[model samples]
Target: MQFTSGYGAEPGAWRLPGANLRSYTDMDQFVRYAQAAERGKIQLLFFADTPVLDVDLERQVPHFAIDPLLVMTSIARETERIGLVSTASTTFNEPYSLARQFKALDVISHGRAGWNAVTTSDPAAAANFGRAVPPRAEKYERAHEVLQIVQALWGSWEKDAWVLDVDGKRFADMDRIQPVDLQGRHVASRGPLPIPPSEQGQPVIFQAGGGGYGLELAGRYADGVYANPYTIEDGQAQRQALRDAAERAGRDPDEVKMFAGFMPAIAGSRRAALDRRRFLDESVDLRQRVRYLGAMIGLPLGYRQIDEPLTADQLADAVPSPHDPRSARALEVAREGWTLRDVLAHGVIDYHPVVAGTATDVADHMQQWFEAGACDGFSLAIDGYHDGVDAFVDQVVPLLQERGLFHLDYEGPTLRDHLHAREQYGLDPRVTETAAR
Candidate 1:
């Protein structure tokens, strides 16, 4: 599950009753949240990031307050079993340093760390990095090279590279260590990585993207793929697309796991859940929603006629901005012939599937999607105060476990153990062999 700080992508979540306004900065609170996830045996706790103040300063609460790596480092000390996935942009960071940092984290967390590689889209982030944003094609090309270099560096040291001999006065088998003398068009790195492999090998690689380049990167390298599938059909199509991409790249399709983003306004009862969703929707300003709709449709939508449904032609022609890839979900909702108000209330702008129901209802939705081959798993977005996290862990998780859809306890200690359980169950022969190696 992914939650950096505060409610994920919800502008009005901080203002909810009993919400923690200080969640963005509280280290103790983050530890508590991580522990809650560990209790439910969640495979990964993902942290999304950008190196800029991306949130709206006037209205929205600050989300990415602390660096993700730092927060994960703290949580690493607090939790033992749950995996820590920290976001690092290929756009801003150099490959050698990024690889070394995550390798160190993997060591610290005892193979329970994951690197969420991202090509940042926020234009403002370029100013912080002291460069102009590269063109989309150029950015993706660089990202590909960066990932390649990082992976090569991670594998530079062989499993038996460290001899640790004192009497022989040799600490490492120099012959076993190979230098990654990569001279790629976008980035280059030299020499074998200094750190030895952790118990789970290197940190697991994760990638999130909607475009072709992004999908290709995930298929080629990512062990886990973070995705935004707005509906069941979208999820199935994305899952098949990723599997196709993996096969085209000469990989086992089952090795690449898809994790769809999910944010639900859950309550004890179905009626209460709907009421909670309504309250959350009403908290946001109408003008902001109008702006969101206009951005999604790539047109100037007037708030005066917010109740009127957009014309079919307008919805059909709507092409999302390359930077704002999530706009497609809003366009999808618009294609359903819903009015601007209804689309806004549905919160399609965040580009995640939303559910509002009791624990049983939530479990049913998840089970249906899983059984239908919609996605491998869900990357839950917890509420700001952690109420959602507690509720899901305390309620929905047990129900799923009872149905034999979820694990009653963690199968093993390392993140790879948690992730590779499906492979061990015979999802793919090569993947099982690779995990064993």
Candidate 2:
């Protein structure tokens, strides 16, 4: 299965009880972490991004303090094979500029670059862009238009467009480079990009969103999908829905690889891992937890007591208008009768699948998911930067390889190459071909 090392610091990550991890500001730690992921032959080092800070919650490190592309560029210099996937928002960025930046990254990394396309969902991000948050429909409409222009610009130049012929005094085949000439309601581009395609064509497209519109966007164009399916059944259902959407979009379903986010707390034994998980959960303050939950539900829960049980009436009253993905999930949880105390104690804020176990135990769960066709791979969202990453790479990866569930070594030097490597394990090869186009 494909693996991506999620490199970022979230709330309670650095300040976890009894934890001695370095702060997110430590560049040396980031570099070393990338190296460790490469050593394990992990496919990508994925960086999550946010456009602005929401003051309602507190975090030790500022979210989006360092630009994701800049971070990826620095990491690119340190590692040779692992793909560098940077998040960029379609809501705030101009399509041409964003396309140009990703192209440069792809070239510099020798074609091991990917773009995680996102429409900034936070209201704070809208304020940073000097406007109020647009309606959900409008944001998605803009996103679809932005992606069209970006892809068109990337494909404007033919493979053989550039020619260095000093003898003939010709620099490039001008006729081979066509203008994008795109015009949409939300976005537009006038001509071809300044640069040609990198060794592996354009940077791979990775999409992470929720709800119907998000799934449709991913199916239409994304080469990879970053998803959050908490159970095997959930994963299987989501994967099927994505495939169906791809078919409806007139694209090969296999072209889009769905990767579920998995955060594992690994240790020498399952018991030790569970203990560490408990300590980490206790690190976050009660206020922070309430605020986080409130954000998910799109309601104000900061006034609520942490130890108190939430009534069904209160949950129903808190249901957010417009019904965005996260809010819908929160409503579902509330409908299931989860109380405030249960939410806090069960670590519900981190919604992705959490597996705490020994190396063998972790591998077993992963194998079950893979065999069940629940996901193409997983995005490894470990708790700590140094120790968390090292533990998985050194211990768990070997076990996965021994079980024939993961790759043993690099097959090629590009992100596409790593993604297509899955075909050997019974996936259809046509998906890679369609992705290359």
Candidate 3:
């Protein structure tokens, strides 16, 4: 199945000195951008977020971003066809609330809302939630239980739940109004949810985790997965595992779409693209970049200044576990002792796979992955906002269109239908008191 291109919107993208800050903060700008994405024939607009603000980030730019769900609702009114996805942390919120918000957004947007379900992993997030330290593996365990409860809640109200019999004085049919009185390890909500079944039946369940437990959690429920796979080979392997696991869990294996996060640098020429990447490196402040990188792979680099080669022991000792059950790609890089200097110089730390010849070259790379079954689709990450998207649309998208890999038009009115998803779940709500990691 061919997947659609989705953009991850972060507010501080167009970081030009004296640039109009109003564009990032204003809801109107989001509306304009959503329209622009549709004009480019982009299929989805997803916002990935965490609850805790980076105190350090405020030093660089003013933090004035609106809520993703609210922003998505505004964008939904302004545009058509582009899927609106938002990150909702499962750890701090109840399943009922999360389900309600997503279902309501789906209704308001005519069935275009998407839920990127995440368990907030940051320690600061734990602090914000009144935990001295976040529950480690248990958070994911509870998340598993929570997913079950939410799925059941979505199922609570069947597609034919409402029997509007006005002549008989019946407001609705109580028979179809299934009550998902759920209880789980960490989440519990008794319902009959307030809303009827959403337009698509349920909001798309988008998951982001990279472990055996995480995999099991996804196989049982999620319709899509967001993975930061470094290479096409890694993506393909993970996709296979996801399919195999889902099938084992009695779900349609093909129902789960795999998406790899990709940041491509494209220009008129290969040299120009290379130069652009180099410029991105040179322009970024090294220390701050190092700290950012440190946080990503779970390192505390800012606290220490030892210039030594990293070892397997050092990497393994610091991290509670390997990056995941199957792969230790991040740990492998850390073990090689890639310092901040080396990382910036080589782009080897979070090595982004690039496609940099002409437009043909980039298309060739994309086609290679598609043929290899690396992913059902991709989430395109821009180095900057519109400029990066502009290059892809101007150069690579046409090439893809010519190659028969790109969609000339949208398939359906709703995002769920646009993605060509089959309804895997019916209203059989799995109720639980709380979640298990």
Model 1 alpha-carbon drift over 4 Å, by segment: 7-9, 290-350, 421-437
By lDDT, the better pick of 2 and 3 is: 2
* Model 3's TM-score against the true structure: 0.78
Ranking by lDDT: 1, 2, 3
Q: Cα RMSDs of all predictions?
A: 5.7, 6.7, 6.9
Highest TM-score: give the candidate number: 1
User: TM-scores, in order shown?
Assistant: 0.83, 0.80, 0.78
Give the alpha-carbon lDDT of every model.
0.79, 0.74, 0.66
Candidate 2 Cα errors over 4 Å, as ranges: 1-10, 16-23, 55-59, 286-349, 421-437
Q: In terms of TM-score, which candidate is stronger, 2 or 3?
A: 2
> Model 3: residues >4 Å from true position, as ranges?
1-13, 17-19, 58-65, 132-134, 163-171, 287-347, 355-358, 424-437
Predicted structure 3: clash tally: 19
Model 2, range 332-352, lDDT digits (tens) per residue?
656666566455433455667
Task: Report the C-alpha lDDT of model 1 over 140-171, residue by residue, as the tens digit.
Answer: 88987788788778888888889999999999
Worst 10 residues of 1 by lDDT: 421-430
Distance from true location, Cα of 222 in model 2, Å: 1.0
Clashing pairs in 2: none
